[model samples]
Target: MTSYYDQRGVGLIEVMVAILLLSIAVLGFSALQMRAINATDESLVRTKSLTLVRNLSEIMRAYPNAYVTGSATSFTTASPTATGAVSTVQAVMSSSATSTVTVDAKTIDITTSANGCLSTGTKQETVDSIVKTVPAQHCNMSQLAARDTLMAKKIAKDEDISMTVVTCPGTTTQAIQTQMCVIAAWNDTKAILSDSDANACATSNGVYKTDSHCLISEAY
Candidate 1:
C-alpha cells in the first residue's frame, strides 16, 4: 500500500478534473441560453411584421369604397381620426425591434373627362360622365402621399417607405382615378418583397393599370 499522503494527492487531482468538467458544462448551458434569447427576439420581430400587414389590410377592407372614391374634401391626412389609424399597429413594430416597415400606393389616373347620357335621352343633353378608375389618386394626391408618409413613420418610426400613383385608361366614358393596395414590407435585404411589385397580385382592371406583381421567392 502506498502512503496516505500519496492517496490524498490523487484525490486532489480528481477534484481538479471534476471542477474543470463542471465549468465546461456550465459554459455550454450559458451558450444555449444566449441562443434561445436571440431566437425569441427574431420571432417577435416576424410576428410584428405579420400583424402590421394584417392591420393595414383590415383598414383598407374596412373602408373599401373610401379608397376608390376618397374625396379631397372628406379626406384629412394631417391628423387621421380613424380608429387604430395612428397608434396601435405601427407603434408596436417601431418600438419593439430594429425592423423597418414601408407602404406604397398605386393609382390608375384617367385623363380627359368624357360624355354620356341616360338611355332615355329625353331627360337631358349630353352629360359629362367621369368614372374615376380604381386605385385612385385624386386632387388630394399630395394629402394622400403625405398620409402614406406619416403612416410609414408611425409604423416604422422611419420614412423609408414609398408611394407611387400611376396614370391609366379609365372606363369607356369618363376619367377616373383609384387608389389600390398599400404594401407593407421590411427594408431588409433579406425581406422577400417590395412595394413596386405589390400590384402584380391584383386583378387587371384594364391595360391602364400599372404592373404590380410580387416576385416572391420559393425559399419563402
Candidate 2:
C-alpha cells in the first residue's frame, strides 16, 4: 500500500506546474483585454470626429446665403473683414477645432454686418438695407478642414492628413447644387489611404476602406 505522505509530496510538483500554466493563461487574457479597450477608445474618437463634422454641415446649411456669396464675416468680430470667401472660414474652422470642438457660425466669419450694405440716395446719403439687399450664397458652403486636424491628432506623431475641398463637377450657382464631397485622409501613413488611391481598394487587417473611412461628403 502507498503511504499518504508519499502520495501528497508526489502531487506537489504537478500542482506547481498547473499554477504556473494558469498564471500564464491569465496574463495572456489580460493583454488581449487591454488591446480590446484600446481599439474601443479609437473607435469612439473617430465617431466623435465624424459627428462634429456633421454638426458643422448643419450649421452651414442654416446660413446658405453667406457661404455662397463669400460675404461671411469672422465669428467673434463684429465687422466684416473681407469679401465673402471660403478660404477665410476654412482656415478659421480648421484652427478652431484644435482648441474647441464646437464652433458657431460667427467663429467661421459666416455672419453678416450692416457695413456690408451699400449706401444709397444723395439726400440722406444712407438707407436701411433690406435683408434681401445683400444676396447670400446660393448653396451653403460647408468647411471640413477641421476634420483633417482632428484625424492627425488621433494618428502617429509623424502622420499628417490632407483636406482637399472638392467642388461638385458643375456650376455651384444652381438652385439644387450637386453635393460637394470633402476628401480627408492621412497622406503619409499607409495605414490609412485616400479615397481615390488604389491602396483603399484592398482589404487588409479585416478592415475594409469604405466611404466613411476617408471621404466625408457634406451633402445631406
Candidate 3:
C-alpha cells in the first residue's frame, strides 16, 4: 500500500493526458466542421449552375429558328485559362469578333450579337415567354433570343455562377439534327473524377472535359 502523499503527482499527470486528448479531439472536430461547410458551399453553387444551364436550354428551345445551328455562344468562366480558380466566364458570340468582359484586369468571355445568341439581361427568364404584346402580335425571334440571353446572364450573375452555351455536333446517323449545350462552371477543386485534371467543363465543341468542374445540359 502507498500513501496518498506518494501518489500526489499521479492525478496531475492523468489530468494533463486527458487534456491533451481532448485538445486533439477538438481540433479534429473543427477541421471536420470546416470541411462540411466547404462541401455545402460547393454543392449550392453547382445546383444553381445546373438550374441556370437548364434555363438557358429551355430559352433557346422556345425561340425556334432564332439560333443558327452551326454557330456557338459561350458564357463561361471568367478565367478559362486558370485551372480550378474560382471565377466565372461568359462567352459572347460575334460569328466574327470575340466579345469579352474585363474586370480586375482579367478577361471573361461574353456572347455578342451573334446569329444564334442575342446578348442581353438576366432572370425574368420567363418574362419573354409571356407574349406580353399589347395586341398579341408576332414576336421577333431575334428579340426573344436576346431577351433570353439577358435573363440568363442576370440570373447567373445573381448566383455568382459561370456559364457556357454552345452548339454541339449532334449525331447524324439516321437524320440531321442539332444539339445545344449549356454548361455551368464552378470551383470544384476537391471532388471525385477530379483526380485526373481540372478541365471538366465544356470544350469548344461542347464536349465534356474529363475531371473538370462543370455541368452540362443539352437541347435539340
Candidate 4:
C-alpha cells in the first residue's frame, strides 16, 4: 500500500509540470500577436504621412510665383470661418524687382534736363487711337496655394497634418535663386519602443519626441 501511494504522488507532479509549460507557450503567442498588430498600425500611419507630403509638393509646383514671392500666410481648417479643412498651410511669397504700371496713350522718351535731372518727355504726334488700360490679373497665388494645401489635408482625412511653404535663398554661379520648400508634419499613433526608435523617426527640426513624423521637399 505504501509503494502505491508514492507512485500516485509522482504522477500528480508530472501533470503539474506539463500544465505550467503549456501556459507559458500561450502567453508567448499572445505577446507576439500584440506586437504584430502594433506594427501594422504604424505602417498605415506612415503611408498616410508620405501621401500628404507628396500632395503638398505638387501644390507648390503648380503655383510657383505665389509660393515663392507672396507674403507668408497661415491658414487653419479648424477655424469656424475656414473655407478649407487643412490643418494648417503656411506660405510666403518672396520679393522681386518687377512692377506693373499704366501709362497714357503717348510716346515718352528718356531725356535729361538742364540740371542733369532725369525727366520724361512726351512726343507730340498725331492722335489716332484711344488706349484702354487693361487690368492686370492679380496672381492670387498665395490664396490658391493655401486652398490646395487644405484640400490635400481634407482628402487624407487626417486633421493633425500640417504644411508649410517657405522661400529659401540658394546661391548660383550667376545670382542668388529663390527655392521653395514644402514641409509636412503629423502625429504618429505608434508608441516608441526605445530612444533609438525615436531618433530614427526624428523630423527636420531634430526633435525625437516619439510622437510625430515629418517630411520636406523643395522646388525651384
Candidate 5:
C-alpha cells in the first residue's frame, strides 16, 4: 500500500528540482542582458569616433592650403611668463616658420602661413594674420595630404583615439590624382565589434577601427 508520507516526500523532491532549474534560467537571462548593454555602449563609442573622423575630413577640405602647403612651420616659446594682462594678440606668421610668444599667461603656438593659433596650458583669444594674400598656382598634393594626417592625429588625441592618413602608393611624389585614406581606432576591451579592414587600423584585445577614403583631383 502507498503511504501518504511517501507521496508528500516525492512531491517535495520534485518541487526542489523545479526551483533549481528556474534559478539557472534566471542566471542565463541576466548574463544575456548584461551582454546586450555592453554591445550598446560599444556601438555608441564607435559612432562618435566615426563622426570625429568625418569632421576632420571636412575641416581639411575647408583649409586645403593649410594641409596642402607643406610650407607651414611651427615653433615653441622659449619661456612663457604669465601676464595679468588679458588681450588678444594678432601676428602674421609665415609658412614653414614657428614662433612662440607669451600672451596673457598662456604660451601660444603661432604658425605662419597656416590658419588658427594653438595655446598651451591656458586658453587665450588670438587673431591670426593672414599670411597668403594670393593663392599658389600649384600645390604639392602629397605634402598637403601628409599635413592633413598630422592634424587629424592632434585633434583625436584628447579622446585617446588613434588616427592614420595614408596616400595611395605611399610616395611623396606630387600627383594630380590620388586617394587619401583616414583611419580612426580606439581600444574596445569588450571585443564587441570588428574593424572595417584588417590593415586599416591596429587592433588588440577587441579594438574597433574604421576608415574613410576620398579621391582628390588637382587639375591644372
Candidate 6:
C-alpha cells in the first residue's frame, strides 16, 4: 500500500512540468509572431523601393540628363534635397495661364503668372473644388534635374530607406548600353554607395551583393 506522504509533491511535479511546457509554447508563439512582423516590414520596404526606383527612372527619362546621353557609364552621387512629399504627378509640366494639371493623382486647376513659370507664381486646385495652395512644377528648366533628384531623395527618406541614381557600370561595350542603376538599401548601417572592391548593394561593377538587404533596378 502506498502511503499518502509518498505521493506528496507528485502532483506538484506534474503541475511544474505543465507550467514549463506552457511557458515554452508561449515563447515559441511570440517568436513566430515577431518573425512574421519582420517579414511583413521587409516586404513593405521592398514594394516601396520598387515603386520609388521606377519613379526615379521615369523622372530621369523625362529630364534627359547626361547619364541618358553619355553612352559611357559615369558616376553621379548628387543627393539633392527638397521639402515635402512628392506627388505622383506624371505630367508634361507645360506652362500655360489657364490649364488643368494632375496633383497627387488628381487633376486640378492650374494657374500661373503671365511669365509662365511656377518659380514666378502658381496656383493649384484639387478635383474636390477645394482650393489648396500647391505650386505646379512646370517650366523650371534649370531645376528639372535638381527636382528629379530631390523627389528621389525625399521619397527614399520618407520610406526610411537609402537610395541613389548611379550608373550601372556596363561590362560589354557592344551589347550592354550605358544604364543607370537605382539602388535601394534598407536596414543597412550606411548609405549604399558604390564600392569597387567591397561586396555592396550593386557593387561598382554593377554586381549586387547577396548577403545585404539591398536591391538594384536598371534605368536607361
- The lDDT for every candidate, in the order shown, is 0.34, 0.39, 0.50, 0.43, 0.39, 0.52
Question: After aligning candidate 4 to the native by TM-score, how far in Å is the CA of 88 from where it should be?
Answer: 11
All candidates' TM-scores? 0.39, 0.43, 0.57, 0.51, 0.47, 0.60
Candidate 6: residue 204 Cα off by (Å): 3.3
Query: Global CA lDDT of candidate 4, please?
Result: 0.43
Cα-lDDT of candidate 3: 0.50
TM-score of 3: 0.57
Off by over 4 Å in 2: 1-9, 67-125, 128-165, 168-178, 182-215
Model 3: per-residue Cα lDDT over 1-220, one tens digit each = 4696798889899999999999999999999999999889878888787778777777666654442221233322222233322112112322222333322322233443432233343232235678332422222444344445655776776676666555444434212124655667766422112224455464454456655667767665
The TM-score that candidate 2 achieves is 0.43
lDDT of 6 at 195: 70
Encode model 4's per-residue lDDT on 97-120: one tens digit a residue.
111111111111112122111224
Estimate, for each residue in 136-209, the C-alpha lDDT of model 1 and write its tens digit: 22324333333333343356334332222222223232121223233333333221222343433323332212
Q: Give the 10-residue window scoring lowest on summed lDDT in candidate 3.
A: 85-94
Q: Judged by TM-score relative to the true structure, which candidate is superior, 2 or 5?
A: 5
Residue 20 C-alpha lDDT in model 4? 94
Candidate 5 worst ten-residue window by lDDT: 85-94
Off by over 4 Å in 1: 59-149, 158-220
Better of 2 and 6 by lDDT: 6
How does residue 33 of candidate 2 score in lDDT?
A: 100
Q: List the candidate numbers ranked by TM-score, top first.
A: 6, 3, 4, 5, 2, 1
Sorted on lDDT, best first, the list reads 6, 3, 4, 5, 2, 1
Find the candidate with the highest TM-score and give its number. Answer: 6
Local accuracy of candidate 5 as per-residue lDDT tens digits, 97-182? 22433222223332443322421233233337544333331223323333334444455556666544334234343322224444
Q: Which ten residues in a row have the lowest lDDT in candidate 2?
A: 109-118
Tens digits of lDDT, candidate 6, 1-220:
3797798899989999999999999999999999999999988988998888788777766654222111111112211222221111211211221143322222333333332233545567564788776565343332344334544666677778877655457633222223556677788623344575344675566656666777878775
| Backbone clash count, each prediction separately | 14, 11, 30, 4, 8, 0
